[model samples]
Target: MYHYDNYDQTLVDERVAQFKGQTERFLAGELTEEQFRPLRLMNGLYIQRHAPMLRVAIPYGLLSSRQLRMLAQIARRYDQGYGHFTTRQNIQYNWPKLEEVPEILEQLATVEMHAIQTSGNCIRNTTSDHLAGVAQDELEDPRPYCEIIRQWSTLHPEFAFLPRKFKIAVSGAQKDRAATQVHDIGLQLVKGDDGETGFEVLVGGGLGRTPIIGVMIRPFLEKRHLLSYLEAILRVYNRYGRRDNKYKARIKILVKELGQDQFAERVEAEWAMIRDQLLLDQAEINRVQAFFQPHPYAELPAEDAILAAHKQCDAAFAAWFRHNSVAHKVPGYRVAFVSLKPLGIAPGDMTDRQMDAVADLAERYSFGEIRVTHTQNLVLADVRQSDLYELWQALTALDLATPNIGTASDIISCPGLDFCSLANATSIPIANGIQQIFDSLDYLYDLGDLRINISGCMNGCGHHTVGHIGILGVDKKGEEWYQITLGGSSANQASLGERLGPAIAKEDVIHAMEAIFQTYREQRLDDEAFLETVRRVGIEPFQERVYGDH
Candidate 1:
């Protein structure tokens, strides 16, 4: 984790004081709701359905055990004993009082954390792969670049109030775990065939009312030009990106309007003019990289008889190992994922106790490094194979192990009408309904690896478009309806899902999903994946089963 220097500390402290005064004025009636709205938004506070939600920025999703403990403390003290981790790798406390929020920020400053740029469209937190520093197949540790972007984007004067929010994600992994393709500016660190490191820069990718996978602007951007090129992209967006309609304001629409070739040309022209004039350079990146140097991890024995025994003795442990464990760069250690989508519980919602348990596990089993993924899961990057059972025991006590890591029941859902005012329907309830239907482990695995992602609105908070079976909440004459899309995924073969038919009512949404899955179960050829079946046999067959019954 990058520690804040005196300069960073001063900025945060000053902002806290400024926000405290703003809060006081709002409470004293000196500032109207309208006056305080933007101020609160800039500080990452949202007036939700029932109360104020405070979004706490977890920069690049890298946090130490100490930071995780601070979050747990904050949740217990200021929130409703829990925090909701978001799709963007930030955390939101749904029930924070307006007056107490400034105090919360003040406390956070002590831990080098703040909510600045977590909301209100001003270059939100730059997220990265959860296993950035530790992934075995990584080209490089992405945290340094993510941190560099964080420093550049935070409180940027020119982009303070853009037409719409901007988001960026970076990943160095062979797998696009950061979902870089779906961001406003997506960066993938790649090693060239000639053994040189560069970036695969994607422009105009985003999710919201409209979803578009980013188009590659530069296939191989030199490491030295990273920051300058980013500045060029921002300059281009600021120059010509739409401000008339919020829906059309994202860079994706800009690229769509002016074809990618023209957009790339414009960016190239912009880069040619001012690449050297940007605030950052190779020296700055080198300085930042020094701050994010990997920590020393203790070496462990390669052979682990104990781990083998646990795997052989416990069927539950075997299932968990198959799903949650991934190879680590180090020989004897592996990365383990703490799945947040345990059955019947709200996805990404964690109690204070559970948070503490995770902190303990991160500190004990793995190195003290903890990471938050865009999928709302936690990663223990350096867990030794020998300690898997002990770590599993601790996690089990916290109800963290359900052995349904990536199955039908392990659904990706958003906090819908329950918290978000923009939501047309309750997303949590829909997720729960889906979980209830696929409660049986055998049924879920037999149904095969399916992703059922739901969103309350078209904002794509749940990343519904990339789901194997995507569901979007719709507003139809004061009633809530859900539209389904099929065959989408965020992987090597990325593609947007196609809609099946007319939207179904809220009551029928879950049933419609059941019909689709049942239809696939009957129609799939020879254990073909859900996505393969959806592609081979189009949405028509599933539509017939769903709409036919309705």
Candidate 2:
């Protein structure tokens, strides 16, 4: 994890003092609600349906065990006994008092964390693969660049208060776990012919009311020019991106209206003027890279007999090993994913006890490091293979070992109408409903590698547009309804899902989803994945199966 320097601490401390004053003024009736709106938003505080929701940024989803403990303490102290981990790799406290938020920010600053840029139309958190350095198939570690971007964009005066919120993702792996293709700027770190690294820059990709995959603006941007190129792109968007309507304010719309060619040309023209001024030198890059150098690892055998014996002895342990663990770059290590999607509990909700338990596990087994994933899960990125059984036992005791990381049961869902004022229906309940319907671990494992995502509204907070099965909440004639889509993905070959059919009544959503799955079971070839079957047979079969009775 990147430690905060003196300058970083000073900036966060000053911001906390500023917000404390602002909050006191608002409570004392010195600042009107309208006047306090932007200020509160800039601080990542939202007036939710029930109470003030505070979003705390977890930069690049990396957290030290100390930070995790701090979050647990915050959850127990300021708000409820739990917090919700979000798809953007951030965390939300839905019941914090508006006045106590400054204290919360102050607590976060102690651990080198903050809520800045988590909301309010500024450059949001720069996210990367949860297993960035540890993944077996990565081209290079991308977090150094992600940190650079975080430093450059944090409180950038020129880009603050843009027409709409902006998101950026960087992928170091060929598998694209970061969902780079669906961000405002998607950066793929790749090597050039000279054996030096650069980025494949894609711009204009986003999801919401209107979803579009990013277009490749430059085939390869040299490492030195990454920040300069990004500056140019933002400059062009700030100049010409939509401001008249919030719905049309995203860079995707700008790219759409101007056409990719015109957009590229304009960015190039802007780059010519300011590229030299903003270039990041090699020394700066090396400075950031040093913060993430590999930890001291011990020599161990590639395979452990005890691990193999444990897998043979316990079926539950075997299931967890198969579903939740991935290969690590090191010979004796495995990256273990902790699933938050257990049945009946809200997906991504973590109790203070659970948070503290995870922190303990990270400290004991993963070099005191933890990572948050885009799927609202956590990662023990450098766990030794020999300690798998012990860690699994600890996690299972905490109700965190669901073993459904990529299964249908591992759902990505947003806090919908229950907490969010923008939501049309309750997302957590719908997610629970689906989980209940698919309760059998055997069944979920059989239905391998399926992604199910639900969003409360069209804002696509859950990234529903890219799920293998996507559900969006809708309002119809004073009742809650749901619209389903199929074939969407956020992987290397990303694509938007097509709507399955007309929106279904909320109560019948589970049945409709079951019908679609049944159709797939009957039509798919042997060993065919859900997405493969969808692409091979198209959405027509599922659509007919879901809506034909109506």
lDDT winner? 2
TM-score of each: 0.96, 0.99
Model 2, residue 532: distance off in Å is 0.9
* Weakest ten-residue segment in model 1 by summed lDDT: 274-283
User: Residue 220 in model 2: shift from native, Å?
Assistant: 0.5
Badly placed stretches (over 4 Å) of model 2 are none
lDDT tens string, model 1, 267-286? Answer: 99999997777645668778
Error of 2 at 459 (Å): 0.9
Tell me how candidate 2 scores on lDDT: 0.93
